[model samples]
Target: MSEQSRGVTVTPQDDRYPGLVEGYNHRFTGRPEAVRLAATTQDVVDAVQDALDTGRRIAVRSGGHCFEDFTASPDIQVLIDLSPLAAVSYDERMAAFAVGGGTRLDHLYQELHDGWGVTVPAGTCFEVGVGGHICGGGYGHLSRRDGLVVDHLYAVEVVTVDDTGRARPVIATREPDDPHHDLWWAHTGGGGGNFGVVTRFWLRSAGPRPTAPEHALPRAPRRIRRADVVWSWDTLDEQSFTALLRAYTDWHEKNSAPDSPGRHIWSNLIVLHRSAGSFILNSVVDDDVPGAAELMAEQLAVLTGPGGAAPAHVEEQVVSWMDTWMPSYSWPSDPRGRYKNKAGYLRAGFTDHQLAAVHRHLTDPGYDNPMACLVLTGFGGQVNAVAPDATAVPQRDSILKASYSAGAWTAPEEDELHIAWVRRFYQDVYAETGGVPEPGDVNDGSYISYPDVDLADPVRNTSGTGWPVLYYKDNYPRLQRVKKRYDPRNVFRHALSVALPS
Candidate 1:
């Protein structure tokens, strides 16, 4: 390839090229001219500069867990891999935890919990990189009590391209008086690959600055109570299924308050297609909470009581937080790599009519994919305590987050069949809104973390709302301004990236 930088550069002829070209989703791959393995901030700066100097389109990859082809598109000529920059430590100078942008969630949890009894409320997918997750306003089990990852963000070190096309590292913090304060706000939930390559992020709880590392972030839970409740397809009819979903959502609507007792409880209802044999509801709560067991039991009773169909199986346990937070912790695996994901935020529970659509699609006899499923995860609580304009993530009143996904296929020919199933399933659920979730009283719009390009496609998204409005709401204009100031050349961009201010 061209002259190499300080970091290692692999070209198409390199033996490692094949592996680097692909990402978590096997659906997309790139044949870039070169893949630069950046191990430090300077390395990323040099790599980005090289790409700009050569007039080659570039993209950055960390844990390779992106659901879309943003980084692996064929148009990318230079792929900058940041996995080597993974590092986690307390920054004495900033009085915050300094996490490498490339660090995985699992690694970050381990380092934070082991070194200091603290952790950020990040996503549960251990393999996800912090680079995109934090910027996209990630949330997880602790989110109900702790808020989103971005809510605790103190500062970020991003390598940005100036108007002169020179790449340099800049540090932006939450301090309003700071010159680059807006840059920090944009990264809060602006999504990744929009402004520039993030080299590092410093996290600290919002409030008075803590003098010690251990007190810098939210304290990690000592133990957690978990329950797995499953119901077989044979046990569920259309009425029962609808009741079950309604009951789950209704509970969240009532309990998703900043000071609600149920804020400590986090649950996910995984509704699989009939071909999967059964669906599951996984719930967790901090065992240290008073009456934790009783709270979980009561929640379970509400769900089963409505349907009158007892769960086919129920398992409960109490385990150390490390047992669940460690990188070794594993969940059910999908052998098939290719997948499609779409998500939306719900301000209230699904109506009866919407529930019927969900039941009809999951039980459709024409589609037999076992991996196809709908997941509704608990959201809000502390996440809603923040003002809508305080961060780029403006959906502050959502109670539940719903994700529609389809996977488990090895052949490319099955792409159309699997993709169409999920698209139709999502469309029918929001049929009242022109085939996509539009901002309204019930649906607040979609999540940027689970980026769905289909929202940008006119053929798929019959809704008049554009993708920018769906993901950012009124915050899009602010993000566009940040894009103009930091990346005037638009050096960092992808399919769903913020467009320049017109």
Candidate 2:
């Protein structure tokens, strides 16, 4: 390791290189020429400037939770590791919380709630880094009730290169009088690596500005009620499976209104491949709300209504928000298996054909991966209350978010098998539109957070709607302008980065 401008730089043969290059998904291997562990904003500035002057391809790694290899690409020569810049502090000048881009969701949640009794609606995965998650318009359990995490974003401090190729740090806020307002708007949902390196994110409530930190963001829930209802795959016949999906989709379509009671509840239906033994519906509701138990019961009834068979087991619990706020939040297993994932947004329920395709692929005995599954989580409600162009995130009218994923052996030899399995599964399900989920009645494009590079591949994405339209819709043009302005040199870019203006 060598000290460089207040940060540490290491080569592939260095002792820290192995740990620094390892990301959440073990499938990809990154062997950048140098890795810079930035301890502060200045360190990042210096590292970036050095890379720029030296003509090296730059990449950044925050939480390393990206499903794709944006940060782990082979073209990368310099990797800026922002994990050391993790800090959560109150900004008296802004009257809001200033969270370092490197801060993980778990630490940010704990500090914000414990220090000020406030929280930003964000992703469920605790290990996710704020750098990418917020920029991609992150949503989770509290989203339906409070809106998106970016909705609370007030400002961002980022490092950028000027027209003369001079690296500098700039802050952009939502204030009307702020000259960098466009820069701030771009970060709302423009996705990371397209503009610049975000060092800090200022979070506050969407409404009236508060003079104090305690009153800045929405108050954290007092307690949360959670339940896990499981159904054995062996006993779940096609009739029951079809019924279960219908009940789930029907309920979402009926209760997606901004004022619907379902807004207080959020759930994910994990339809794992048959090898998993059972499918589970894990849900959570605000325990402090009136009739909370009844709401959960209502959802359970719908879930089991189709099967008519009793759940193999039901586990229910109520705990303070702080106790189980970050459920299932854990570090990734070392030497994990190779993985591939795809995502789609739905404005309504799944079509009968789509449902049948799901059953057919999941029940197929040809390919095997117990960890493979299609997880559908209820969306909309408060999310749809915002206008389509309120921020860079335009998928405001969606009712559900579907994720198609598979995890298989880490051995290089098995990579093709798992990748093929997930690709074929997703393609067959969306055969009506194309290999990809085109924006339409059944699918409303894809989520940038769960990005799939295949969407940009012509052979893979037969969906007539190009990749940019699927993710940004009409917002793509605006994002391009921001890209041209902030990243003129395209110093920070990857496979799916926002494109520059033609």
Candidate 3:
């Protein structure tokens, strides 16, 4: 067998492979005994097939954004890094964009928006890879107006290893009647890298199309309202916190729909900065400036100031919605910046007491990180109106898809504490929202893209919710079937990957 690097290889590990490294994720890097940077579909297939034949564990990296170390873990000896396999092009016949799985989300945006004038309902972060990004039912600013990323996904090219340890690449389309129809469903939101190593994706036909003006995509929105409201941990008491949660919840329930005149031209970045030890409420809405700014000012005023305009970052923008969103957080239009992330979906908002609990957690300041922010993104509109069975992501009807994370910390020691804080916060705030999987009144089903390996571990995510069930919901079964069909030997097993049922 070919052996390279410091680790021993049971199978023939190509010592010449240059991509092998020690650390890989945005948060933690992974060192692999051998790393193969595949340039073609054949390479991906061979990597999978080799891992199966040699009884070696394998992990795939596209944008290195897997919240956990699933793809970037050191325990993973053989790594297949696909970030270099990226290539995007337009298909005249399909009228949809053919995007490589390795391509970054923002790169696709630049191609579709700047080159084509079209845009996909994708993640806000430009660096996120389209590979695993869309597979987890990706959502972005456009989600409220359009839908999640899967809503616009038309097809995918994937490589999976069967029980015989033979890797086969399959091209699955969203035809609904195709032989591999179930495979497409599994890819929609089943979580990437588990069922197969997807090489390319076909955007939906009826969805956004690239044009020259925007690049062939939908023209950027003309005017937008960028706003923010901050509350000190000391100021937001239990009653006020509850009122804030209720206010947001009520606003969403009262005005959610693609065609609603009161459509939210908004995004709330609920932040907890350990350094400052304060919570900043940031928002940006796409509504009639004069009308919405006033109406919204009132709705929020009840919970915030006595009256007057919103404080800090408060203003209505008349430029393109695309540009307006860029400066909301000084998040430049660049994807090269590396990031560490964790996300959660609120089936509902927090209760009054729960808000107070969160305030308390933020104030205690257990971890010190600059890029720390608990972003609360309101989700619900055309995306949620669809049924869970309809796509790979089932948390469609979520009232708020919140993202809890502490971005960059130079020291490895801080990772455990920050991550621990998010998980614990999720647990403490869960009871207020009822939590997930059950029908009664639950709202805490985590996002697969923002994977928390802790959820899969009995000791970490003691919430009793399993990985597949929490991430895929009822769709977990189909994902398992696909896993068995492609990766039967379980070569891709990771902390949070979908497993073939015993």
Error in Å for residue 487 of model 3: 2.4
Write model 3 residue lDDT over 275-382, tens digit each, in one string. 554555555555644476775565566445442223343444444555556544433322222345555666555655567656665555555565666677767776
lDDT tens string, model 2, 55-132? 999998888877888999999999998887788999988988999888998899889888888888887777789999
Relative to the true structure, candidate 3 reaches a TM of 0.83
Look at candidate 2 and tell me the lDDT of residue 367: 81
Q: Which ten residues in a row have the lowest lDDT in candidate 1?
A: 325-334
Candidate numbers, best TM-score first, in rank order: 1, 2, 3
lDDT of 2: 0.86
lDDT (0-100) at residue 451 of candidate 3?
75
Write model 1 residue lDDT over 149-168, tens digit each, in one string.
99999999999999999999
lDDT of 3 at 461: 52
Pairs with backbone N, CA or C atoms under 3 Å apart (clashes), candidate 2: none
Best by lDDT: 1
lDDT of 1 at 394: 95
Candidate 3 least-lDDT 10 residues: 1-10
